[model samples]
Target chain A: MSPTNATPPSERTRVRRVAQRGRYDRETLHAIVDAAYVCHVAFADEHGVHCIPTACWREGDHLYIHGSNGSRMLKLATHGAQICVTITHLDGLVLARSAFHHSMNYRSAVIYGVFDIVEGAAKAAALDTFVEKIAPGRSREVRPGDINELAATTVLRVAIDEAAAKIRTGGPRDDEADMTREVWAGVLPLAMRPRTPIIDAAPSGTPDYVRQWHEIASANAAV
Target chain B: MSPTNATPPSERTRVRRVAQRGRYDRETLHAIVDAAYVCHVAFADEHGVHCIPTACWREGDHLYIHGSNGSRMLKLATHGAQICVTITHLDGLVLARSAFHHSMNYRSAVIYGVFDIVEGAAKAAALDTFVEKIAPGRSREVRPGDINELAATTVLRVAIDEAAAKIRTGGPRDDEADMTREVWAGVLPLAMRPRTPIIDAAPSGTPDYVRQWHEIASANAAV
Candidate 1:
């Protein structure tokens, strides 16, 4: 996003705890949301709060999530209820000389808003966005959802009204006394990647987009 | 746990949607929670619902999470606020002939209960558990938290009364009509691994447990 289009902090979006780690920029939030494959959506009622993990994609300032018509989460969210969508990518494990200093290096984002259920032509376009965002150029290559399929699905999008991104990096910050100890302390890095593309019996070999993404992921994993 | 230690479903734990994916067994829930590095915790209040991602560990029927004493979620949860803790591990990406059939293979668990703040000796033991759990033997080798360090942290646990685990595996389940299309369809396996370990400048050589876990993670990625 342009500098002028950055997200501003709201009362609810402000990071009250560990305030130093919080980021209030649209670019940071967008990058985190776009790179993540799934998010945990939370909604509540008199019964209790429910946090459901589901796939999502970011397009512009909006985040789109879809589910079957029969999904309890989809049904509850479509009624214009408030929701919290959170995505966290664990980067590594922080090892410290003292137990209390142990932590993890990570990047996370939380978005707050009510979802608007897409319908008719808009829903179709949003579903297309989900597939295309998941894998570049694949949406144009594959068959789109049929009428029955579209009717049975529910797509919802929440515009970025309030959001915050938090990140932690670098090696462990051990205490001065503990740092002198002989125990080793540093980050044990963690990463996510596609293992390999399993081609179906179908005629097409692996598509370039898929293969290219896999290669890039594999290369990153190697370092 | 013994055969008699099964986790029976409570009123809220019963899987109302996609019932087939739900598992009420303690063994299943334990395995899913143990493998996950983080969980998205959901809670509601007069203001609204919030989802925060944080580190967690499961031991027996109890799940423990710790945060800075000033954390909003930790404070609310310590005061008997109802909370939902959900952990999800994305295993693979399912590519189907049609967009509607696209999905991901994952293992997830959500536990609902009130958190009890751990204190004194029990808090010390729990912090040890957190360390041992994250990297098994590292706790024994390192010094335990001192007075100030322990006082600065808040550890909380929720004994499981109602919990559910949902998992999806295997290849894409495309419709019979669409399966005949000349489209590649299957699962693109995804996994987590520790990148080359960054040995702290102070080292007794990388511990066997850490090295062994990295080797196993790398071996799995190779296949």
Candidate 2:
């Protein structure tokens, strides 16, 4: 499938609480997924519901995840078990004049669907996409996965068609009565900023991605 | 109950994959929870599995969450529904020499349990603890939740008894064969850093927490 033109492609995807903060567009969903390095996946079995965090990335209209072939999650998901994948980026801490109105600024996306295994040549390409996401040009530099290694990994993707994004930004919205309270109210803005890269035993010159990582974080932090 | 001296207290909480990375101690679980502002809660309903992100805080041996009384998750949880709460802190991107060995450095905690409601005085106190967590001494400066506001909210807590923490740190563990590959290998560390505080229309002087926000980020980033 492609980016959802209409929000809430399914009944379960509708946002009920704080409906004003909900976004059902593809752009919002993709942005949330792309910005995250990890996502929490929710699924159920006889033992009950489980929420596990795993590395994730987005390519076009699908969100991709990979793990060992023996992974409980991948094995269960391969069987077409219904699952929910969520990515949340906590942007800041919203402080209000009243404790009741305090909230956090965050961008969160929730996708509901079943994962389809990516096999054959697409699997290798998908793995490259993930590496490229982390460091451009480095995929070619690094030794590619061997046939045995590739066989041991399972890559799965879920369509972003049934997804909803909920975002909260800016300052706190205090009640009219509480606005006059003598309190320090504002947003303690936060971002996942990069520290100075800790380069390991590189066999050659540093990659462009590593060199620019701190720069990118500084640029984002300034915003 | 105190921190578990023995790990894998229950059958389900056991970490099956990469068992060496798992820690069942309470200290590990508490640190993960304390470091997170939000948690992804997985619960099953007629609509299927749902992973929702909500503001979370740790109060001693329990993880606390609150929402409007009409919240579906709160209502369902109030009824003793078994659920899973997960908190993950992505520390860095681990770029390995081989595509197959690529991984992420993170600290995560998964807790399986049923939520119990906090009522009366304990509920109010629990909310205060959350406020204090966000801003050390600001709880006194802000107007506390009124009776009406308190009545409209529901606070739920789950014991940290059945929990496991998985953490992976340092550089990537590349395969012996790939170790000689001429690739820039290392960690691009990332952290939730505080940007400059965005002060709203405050009626008084800046608080200590707001003042120290950026400094704290700098200190953490240096580490």
Candidate 3:
């Protein structure tokens, strides 16, 4: 109902002005995370901490991420325990004259919360959501997962409670004194777009749903 | 020098199969980490573990990463504690008919180690390595960081003792039964290429170093 507040927990996570290069509102944050198909998830354990890049999808206000059920990290994350999920898209390299100022322009989101494992019907529903997230209407076009396959997968749900999004997009920021130096400086905008789809050797009947979905995705230049 | 033999701590952290993808060899691991300009760092505190994506570069077997020196995670990491560092390049998205089988093809490296604050000359050297890692030859082109600028930055050195690299390339791997299904399946290879260089408004002579660097980069698309 009310506007969802997506604020950083502490001053450390709060982005500074120079580092804050784009809109930090909730809409922008959700849009970037939802549009992305893969997210690099990082978490801590008794042996220290580790991060792995994996695929993720959003369903409503929550995000569902999965990995092999045997994964120790996934097993630990399943008890509705608090964890951190981060998704990032590197836009470009900010080449500054000074090494200290050399940086990257990127869009990233950090979600801090407890993730509950989805099982039974909820699990099936979550899997469907994952499919639809990639291809809006392709879920119905393919056969559903069997019990054996589902048993090997683990899905954890993280509610969007405490979160923050930071983005930097633009040309390099050269110092006034160094501005006249003979060096190249400008933004090379990085974007992802869907290329020509490779239809299977034998397609059922080019599903109307897929056709319409790709049409809209192409129009929006989304991969 | 003999190759550095640093084994990633646990079995889960150790990469399996596809030896090229699982570069446990120190030379290979350091090369990949040095070439990358950004890393997704994951750590935990009172609010749970969180992952923040930022720019990073390596010098020797040690990695240098920076952020607000006052950051909670940074402060925690500076205690010579272990943390997770991951760098990934999403080469392509593998779109499959069934959602359960859908996956992304990418190259990713994960490192776990204690981070210590680099001071004095060590800090300055790390900074130069950071610049050279990103642009190869740009460090000499610009003014180096002064004491005041260096004071404002917080640089942590993560030694490469426990690390692993995993990569997946080529077309999609659909199940034999699902292979005949009527759906699109293949890779959309992602590649990054530098566009025309935009020389700074004010300039010195186009440095031979810069020109030669571009030639080498264009010749090899490894980065």
Candidate 4:
């Protein structure tokens, strides 16, 4: 259902530092986007370059974002301005025997491209994709966006063609001479954990998604 | 320990959409930075614009970043290129009664400025501050960076004068028309949680930081 193969890197997508950690395969890129709830998008305008964080989702080979029709970012993207979107998950802190060798365990994806305005039927369909992503069966329960509400919003998507994923895992790599130092070395892991759901109201029964949110997240972390 | 008051916003730092959520106080800015382990930096180069994620920490009224001297971002930053640094903590997903009103609860700080290179003793001291932030007393235990190691790294810091923080919390705000709909509405809260520490080696006893990592994080989340 996603991009099936890796694409050749463009001049901008090539990873220069720690090149071995770079990945170009679509599978790697898709997994990174799927795990994230938001991404930081960078763009340049008359004032200067700006980086803004916003909710994002993936469908096939494109990454989608929506905002008020008056949003400066959406307005700029609709004009075909180039932009960079990045998502990062900080997994842990890597502790080493030497200060110089300390590092972080993380998974990150960077995508570079221009966004195209999604309109008409496809725009409505895309909104459904986003709602379904956040709360599986709840999309059906919620009142769908009215014509006026949908008209007041803008939806945009960029192809995930020129993207790269970089990942670092495992323990710290300390110099041989420093390894014998009397220090406790290891990793202190971190995760985006789901907490107890705070219900505003539930005239209907709690859906499976809300009921199992914390349990599913805990199980995933254990793996 | 931080900027004492809120400063007037520059043209680029002002929040335009949903302006009520904007925050300008230094206390708010510093808290957002302190809670983050990383930030996405956006800078434009000859190749085009880029958004790169990197480790970051705060000290006084400045934010500091360090990297290998050969890093292109570091090299360009040292030359005084204008950049945008943004740190965001995703707190929860707000599920509204209607699809149009779904939103995310997050705390985000966006700073705009050029970075100044850090050198000599100040650079070394700043690195220690970073290490201390990650693991309180571990700085004294690890073998300090040697002269050569210090020479191979580049440190940079930017003034936090031109910055703004935006935050949203609690339950979703549904339109009156949609509120009576039969949808389970509220927030599905999320947090960056600490898992059990994984030890690679322990020649010395486990420090209080490592021993209390999960407990401390869990307590903070409860608040």
Best by lDDT: 4
TM-score of each: 0.94, 0.96, 0.81, 0.96
The lDDT values for all models are 0.83, 0.89, 0.68, 0.91
Q: List runs of model 1 lying over 4 Å from the truth.
A: A1-4, A213-220, B1-5, B213-220
* Candidate 3 structure quality by residue, lDDT tens digits, A194-222: 43344444355655544553453344221
TM-score of chain A for the candidates in order shown: 0.92, 0.94, 0.80, 0.95
| lDDT computed for candidate 2 | 0.89
Superposed by TM-score, candidate 2 places the C-alpha of residue B127 at a distance from the truth, in angstroms, of 0.3
Q: Give me the overall lDDT of model 3.
A: 0.68
**Which candidate ranks first by DockQ, i.e. highest?**
2
DockQ rank order: 2, 4, 1, 3
lDDT of 4 by residue, A126-210 (tens): 9999999998876688888899999999999999999999999999898989878999999999989887788998888788888
The superposed Cα distance between candidate 1 and the true structure at residue A35, in angstroms, equals 0.9
Give candidate 4 regions above 4 Å deviation.
A1-4, A214-223, B1-4, B214-223
Kindly list the per-residue Cα lDDT of model 1 for residues B9-81, writing each as its tens digit: 7777878777887787888888988898798999987779999998998777888899889888888888898
Best-first order by lDDT: 4, 2, 1, 3
- Candidate 2 chain B worst ten-residue window by lDDT: B214-223
Q: Write the per-residue lDDT of candidate 4 for residues B147-209, one digit (tens) a residue.
A: 999999999999998999999998999999887888889989998988778899989889888
**Distance from true location, Cα of B106 in model 2, Å:** 0.4
Fnat by candidate, in order: 0.74, 0.87, 0.41, 0.84
Q: Is candidate 1 or candidate 2 better by TM-score?
A: 2
Q: Is candidate 2 or candidate 4 better by DockQ?
A: 2
